[model samples]
Target chain A: MFRIAIEMLLYDKTKYIGLLIGVAFTAFLVTFAMGYFAGFMTRGFALVSENPSAKVWVMDPSVSSAEATINMSDSALDIVRGVKGVNYAAPMYLGNMTARYANGDFQTFQAIGVDDATLSGAPKPANLLRIPESAIVDSGGTEGKLQTPIYKKDMWSYDGSHLNAPTRKLRYGDTMLINSKRVVVAGVSHTIPRFPPRPLLYTTASNFKRLVPGEKRYITFIMVRPTKNITPNKLAKRIAKQTGLKAITSDEFKKETVLWYMINSEDVGDMVNMVILAMLVGFGVTGVMLYMFTYENIKQYAVLKAMGASTKQLSDMIFTQVFISAIIGSGIGVGIAAILAHMVSSATFPFRMMWFAPLIGFLGVIIVSMTAAFISLRPIKKMEPGIVFKL
Target chain B: MSKIISTCRDIVKNFNSGEAEVKALQGITLDVYENELLMLVGPSGCGKTTFVSVLSGLLSFDSGVCKLMGEDISTMSDERLTAFRGKNIGFVFQAFNLLPSLSAIENVALPLTVEKRKRVETLTLSKEMLEAVGLDGKENVKPSGLSGGEQQRVAIARALVHNPKFIICDEPTSSLDHKSGQIVMELLTEIIKEKGASMIVVTHDNRIYKYADRIVHMEDGRIVKVAS
Candidate 1:
């Protein structure tokens, strides 16, 4: 019976190719859309995902997501480092700052400052750094010469007193004014998985304090690493109790990132809607094509019925044909989607394929193809054996 | 006389088109006995197909009862009638109604498979039936690959594979050439005798009348004559 169904599906390759293409395109659209959505969400929380040293992040109790918090204190770090599980704890700062170029162009940039002794959340260094005044700028972030000055000759400045620009050219050993104080660029770093947005600059916590000008005791957030026996969640609870603040693990932070995107990000919802709509269109096209195929073969179905085939036999055969189409089409579709994702990633598009999305898409195609078959079953089930004998 | 495998008494079938009702079969009484080859000869619009459909439990009569193996077909629900038909009857049609997707042997094995017979056993039996119909090496060939005569032989093999108590052939050879038609008629006759199963063949072609153990002629939905 399965053989027969497969043969029937293959019998009209030209006709079914159209249906297969419809299903394939639908699968590709669904998978690609989902991949883009996931990529976008990851970008929204790249800071947390890329953090390597922080086993637990202490944040404001009311903060639902990583980006929603305003609470930061050195008091929380002192207490967390004193816990039994804590091996080392350091302050981490995150805030939005405006960077003005020599052309007077301003862009909002996320500023991250970590202790020079323990750079837990800092960007991975591609070049050597030996000075505390020296900073690393993401080379991909700004358009400037390797060692030439692009900005004004004067030292750069920020609105807050915590940050200081040491140099105008932003090269090694060049001084720019950051918050009335001067700092230097030590080295440059390249891209990493889930890197922060372009035009990002990294500097030391001492330089950051010059721009903000608060009690040097306060930090934006705390980073902690557990000892062998200390679990992140347990340490987080201990810290929360001691400092009256919230401590969240990296996994918990990731979840909070996803939650934040789901609540605040409109692109995620739009992508989901688009995927669903594409699937519906795929089902509709396949259904119409399959219906026409069945309609063309109506006489054949009647003939089989006249030959003593039960209704169940006919239904199973048609369903099998639909199943075959979906399997083949989805396989081809996912293959194309994977290739496209890889190729497009090198370009400007932020496309990342989560292995699970294609699997879900494959299952989605099966369900949609079955739905197409179900729509065509009405004509098959109604086929009268008497029609075969009619003159 | 052999046992009466199927009997229909005063069966009436009517079709309703909006408010108008057309009578297709009226007051038709028939008895099909085992081991008998009954041929129903009639003109177009004479309700031959309708009578056979009703007898096969494929359609219901407006009035009167149909009994197959002494079970009331008319009173049985569609589901029960279907089950009963699958077990007790085989059918061959004018168009050589073989499932084109299935190979010759697979087509012949359809009934056994529908009966939920074991796969290996059904295939073995189907191969034997195909060999009996002189399609020995062609079992794996699909219907489209075979000639008209070969396809009809496969159809005959399918009908007889289950060894049902009764067989129904409606214009079984109408689409075949004269020689192929004669061959099919001979094969039907031989199988009917070998299995002791009753067969009712409805056809306008009178060339194969000698193959019938009994011939029933019909006109205007009533039996005009029964010749033995």
Candidate 2:
């Protein structure tokens, strides 16, 4: 009987293909949309992820996310260091500044300041280009437009504001201007691109204060490491208690950053709407196609009923058809999504195919198939066996 | 005398078509005996098809007593009635009603499969039944590939494959040519006699009336005459 059900569904190649297409489209769209959402949220806490050595972060009480932080008093660093479980605390400065290329091209950049002695929050060298231990280096220019140009003694500025054509990519020993002061490009660093992409510039705290020229008490956050045998969460609690600031573990901070973006950003709402639209299309297409398929074969069902097939047997056959469609269609859809995810994925545009993406796609397709099966069953349940004789 | 296999008494069925009530069957009373081919001949709207539907438990009579082999079918639940039908009765439809997706052998094996019989045994039985119906070398041919007479033969083979005690046929030969109709009727009556099963064939075609052991004529939902 199960075999017979499969035969009946497979006999109509048109409807069978239609059903598969409907399910596959749903799965693909849902998976890609959700994957994009996951990737975007991950970038929301890019700062926390970059500085894994920082077990805890102590920030101003008003700070909601990494990108939304307010400057804290420079003295807060010493207070955090005084906590019992704290091993080390470093004052970090985060600000946006403009850098002028040798061609006289100026571009805004995200400037990060680490401790001059330790360079505590700097990107790990294992994941980046190796630099000399003695060189005073700054890193940026991972993007195409931000790449620096080699200097030419005889060449003057093409536009006097932006370079018309860059002769060569920037390398070590190239010089750029920051705040009208010459700054040499010592090393290039690779990092995950920030949301609303901006090139990053890393420098020591003293250099940042000198380059930007600001008032006193300019520390944005204090990155702290817990002492041996003390957990990050425990240290964070102690720091918050001592400094009367918002202190949280790195993971907790990341979550808070993502949550703030989810609540405040319109982009999240747009992504959610795409997911809902995909679901509706899935349900509508599958339900209507299944119903149409069943309607076309109603006479066959009547013949089966009149020939003494019990309702349970017939129902099982219909469900069997639906189950097969759901599995095959979902597999095809997820496979397509994975391929597309591989193609369009980049550091700037976040698209992560998390393990849950396929599971969610499969579950969603199953639900659509089941709803379609129920819709198709309505007519069969109401059919009279005697109608076989009439038809 | 042939053993009585089924009895129908005072069966009345009315159907509602919007605001009007149409009487499909009026006080139909008949007996079907074992190893006999009974023909119910009537024009359209004369209730022969409705009577067989009630007798075969495919329909509910507004008021009647319908019993198959001593069990009252009208009192049976849908599940029980369907089970009983699968175990004891077979059907042949006007259009052959063969599933186009399935080959002749699979069509013939349907009743046994519906009962969830062993696959090997069901196929063997179905093949033999097809052979008996003179469809020996065409077991794997689907209905679309078969001629009308060949398709009807497959339907007859399906009806007899499960060894049911009763068979109900509605306009079994109405769609075939005269010669094909004659061939189908000969094949059907011969198989029923060999299997010792009773059959009720409802049709208005008079060309094959000679195959009947008994004939009941109906008019306006009532039995008009009985001929033998």
Candidate 3:
């Protein structure tokens, strides 16, 4: 019986091509929408997903996510480092600074400063500690737009003033003036595109001290790593009790970041709206296409019923046919969507193809297709078995 | 002495439309005996189809008693009636209503499959029935691919595949050409003789009356005459 249903569906391919195309298009749109949504959310928290060393984060009680700045005394780091079951802790300085290049291209960048000896503890390179008056920039920010020219000279002049040359051109790297001090680029790191989609420059605490004098030895946050037999939350509680500040585990911070993105990020809302629209479009396309397909075969169904087919058998046949169509059409749709996502990612699009996005999209297509097929049962139930002999 | 396979008593069917009640079958009572080919001849707008539908347990009468093999069919539930019909009653329609999706053998095997029989046994029996109806080489062809005569032959094979105790045909050859109609009637008669199953066929075509063991003529929802 299932074989019969399949044959019937395949027999009139030309007649049902429109329906197949409709379902396929719906599936493609749904997958594309969901893929983009997942990509956007992941990128929104790339900083949290990539950070490896910081087991707990201490913040002001008012702060909710990484993008929020919580002011705390520099003494907190020392107190956390001295606690039992504590391995190491370091102060991290974060601020926004405007950078001006020789070509009159001005860009706002996040300034991150760590103690010279404890740079590795905060997930920064040791090379950044050795390069005085120099910073490491995020590669993704510069790789495409600012194709800096590579030069081997030890020194270079920007705005007719001599500054130490960058060790590497570093994609978007350039000699820039920060608060009347020259800072060269020493290396490039993988880009992290969390809340603020801007270039990042990592420097030592000494450079921060020199550039912004009398700024008070105040760090925005602290990073900590625990020793054996110590959970992050327990260490965080101990640190909080001793330092008079809040301490958060990395997982807690990640959850807060996601919540912050959902509530505060403008793009997140827009992407969610786009996903809802895509689902509606999918429902519309599938419903209309499948309804029309069943309508065209109404007489055939009547004939089958008149020939002594039970309602269960007829309904089962119809369901089998729809299931086959959904599988084939969604398979093609997801295949196309994956290729499209890859192409977009390779290009200049701010998209990431997470490993789980395809699975979610495929499941979405099946759910939407089954819903459409179920709606088509109304007309089938109304079919009269006696109509076959009327003609 | 032939056994009485089906009996209808005091069958009455009415149609209601906007406060108007129209009588379709006025106390139709008839008996169909074993190993006999009976034809119910009637004109348009008569109750021949309604009477047959009630007899086959496919429709409910307003008031009537229908018995098949000494069991009251009118009181049977839909599920039980369906099972009973699949087991003991076979039907052939004038449209040669074979599913276009299935081949001739598949169409013939439908009743057996509905009975939850093994596929091998069903297919083998269906193939044999098709061959018995003189459709040996066309088992793989769908009804749409066959001619009217071949399609009718497939329908007859489906009706006979389950070895039912009785066969009910509604204008079985009405859609065929004269020669094709004659062929279908002859094949049906041959099958009834070979299998010893009683048959009741309704038709207005008088040319095929020679194959009937008894003929019942009807008018205005009432039986007018009976001839044997």
Candidate 4:
């Protein structure tokens, strides 16, 4: 009976293919949209992700996320260090600065200023930096939005600023003006992108102060490592209690960052909407197609009924057809999504192949299949076996 | 005296078409005996189909008794009736109602499969039945791949595969040519006789009436005459 059901489904090549495509489209659209959403949220807390060793983050009380920062007073670093169970603490500066390339192209960057000595919160190969003198650009930005022009004989004018030169990539020793101050790119670090997607520049706290002058205090966050015996949560609470500032474990800060982005960003809402719409479309198409398939074969079902097939046997046959389509369609959909994720991520878009995305898509396909099967069962249930004689 | 395999007593069945009630069968009374081919011949709308449908348990009568092999079918629940039909009655349809997706052997195996028989056993029985119906070496051919005569042969094989007490054939030769119809009737009558099972063939085609052991004529939802 199961084999017969499968053969019946496969008998009409056009209908079977249409059903698969409907299910596959749904799975692909939902999974890809949700994956992009997760990728963007992950980038919402890129700073925390970079500094895995910093278990606790101390910030001004008003700060909700790493991107939405308020500069803490310089004394907050000392206060965090003085707290019990605090192993080591370092002040970090986060501020936006305009970079003017030699070719006079100006771009805004999120400048991250780590401790000159320990380089806390800096993405590595930051340890290889000559203490406070130079900067590192994120690898993604080096390929996009931040390219420097290479010289061409006919492309250049008298002065370098107006030169219409063919571009070569920025590399080591590329110098740019940061807030009218000269800074050299010492190394390129591979870092996760930010939510709003700006180029990241890493430098020392001293260099940061030099680039953006005349601030009384410039510490945006203090990265703290808890003592071996104390958990980061306990240390954060102690630090918060002592300093009257917001101190939270890295995981908590990441959650807050993701939550803040989810609340504030319209892109998240759009992605979620797309996922829901895709699911609905998938469900509708599958349901309609299955119903049509069953209706077209209503006579065949009557024949079966008149030949003595029970209602349960007919139900099993319908369900069997549905589940087979669901499993295969979902598998094909997820496979396409994985390939798309790889292609889009290589093009520097926010897409992560999270494990749960495919699982959710597969489950969604199953649900759609089940609904379609139920819809198709209506004709079978109302069918009279006597109709076989007439039809 | 042939053993009586089925009895239908004053069976009445009605249909609702819009606001009007159409009487499809009016007090039909008949008996089907073992190892006999009973033909119910009538013009369209004469209740021949309705009578067989009730007798075969594919339909229910409003107020009458239809007993097949000594069991009252109208009193059986849907589930029990379906099981009984699966185990007792075989059907051959006007259009050869073989599933287009299934091969000849698979079509023949359908009744036994409905009875929850083992796959190997069903296939073995189906293969033999197809051979008996002169469809050897065409077991893997789908209905569309076979001619009308061949398709009807597969349908006949299916009807007899489960070794039912009786076969109900509705317009079995309507779609076949003269020669094909004769061949199908010859094969059907020969197989039913060999199995000692009765058959009820409801058709308007008079060409194949010579194969019947008993013929019942119907008109305006009533039995008009009986001949042997």
| DockQ for the candidates, in order | 0.32, 0.65, 0.29, 0.64
* Order of models, best lDDT first: 4, 2, 3, 1
Estimate how well candidate 1 is docked, as a DockQ score. 0.32
Per-residue alpha-carbon lDDT of candidate 2 for residues A1-391, written as tens digits (9 for 90 to 100): 9999999989879889988898888888778877887778777677788788898998999997898868988888878878898889998899987877677667677888778777787665522212321112333323564555554741335546446655465566666678876666655667765654567877777778878886576789899999998999998888888789999999999889888887887877777787788778776876677678777888888778777788889899989988998899889999998998888784345888889888898898888778888888888888878887876
Model 4, runs deviating above 4 Å: A60-62, A98-106, A123-144, A147-190, A211-217, A227-245, B1-4, B9-12, B17-22, B60-65
Task: Give me the candidate number with maximum DockQ.
Answer: 2
Better of 1 and 2 by DockQ: 2
TM-score of each: 0.83, 0.87, 0.83, 0.87
**Pairs in clash, predicted candidate 4:** none
Model 2 agreement with the true structure over B63-91: per-residue lDDT tens digits: 98999999999889998999999889999
True contacts kept of each: 0.32, 0.67, 0.22, 0.67
Q: List where candidate 1 sits over 4 angstroms from the true fold.
A: A6-11, A14-27, A126-134, A139-186, A192-198, A214-218, A283-332, A345-349, A366-391, B1-3, B20-22, B77-79, B118-125, B206-228
Per-residue alpha-carbon lDDT of candidate 3 for residues A43-111, written as tens digits (9 for 90 to 100): 655655665687887776677877767556777677777888778777777777776654434556777
Off by over 4 Å in 2: A84-88, A98-107, A123-188, A211-217, A225-244, A346-349, B1-3, B18-21
Please report the TM-score between candidate 2 and the true structure.
Answer: 0.87
Docking class of 1: acceptable
* Whole-model lDDT per candidate: 0.75, 0.82, 0.76, 0.86
State the displacement of the C-alpha of residue B220, model 2, in Å, after optimal TM-score superposition. Answer: 4.0
lDDT of 4 by residue, A1-391 (tens): 8998999999989989988888788788778877888788788788898889999999999998987888988888888899999999999998989988767777788889989888887777877556446888874333466667776432223555644556665678777887788888887787887777778889988889999999987999999999999999999999999899999999999999988877877876776777677778766876777678778888887778777889899999999988998899888898999999999989878888788889888898888788878988988887778888876
Which of 1 and 2 is the better model by TM-score?
2
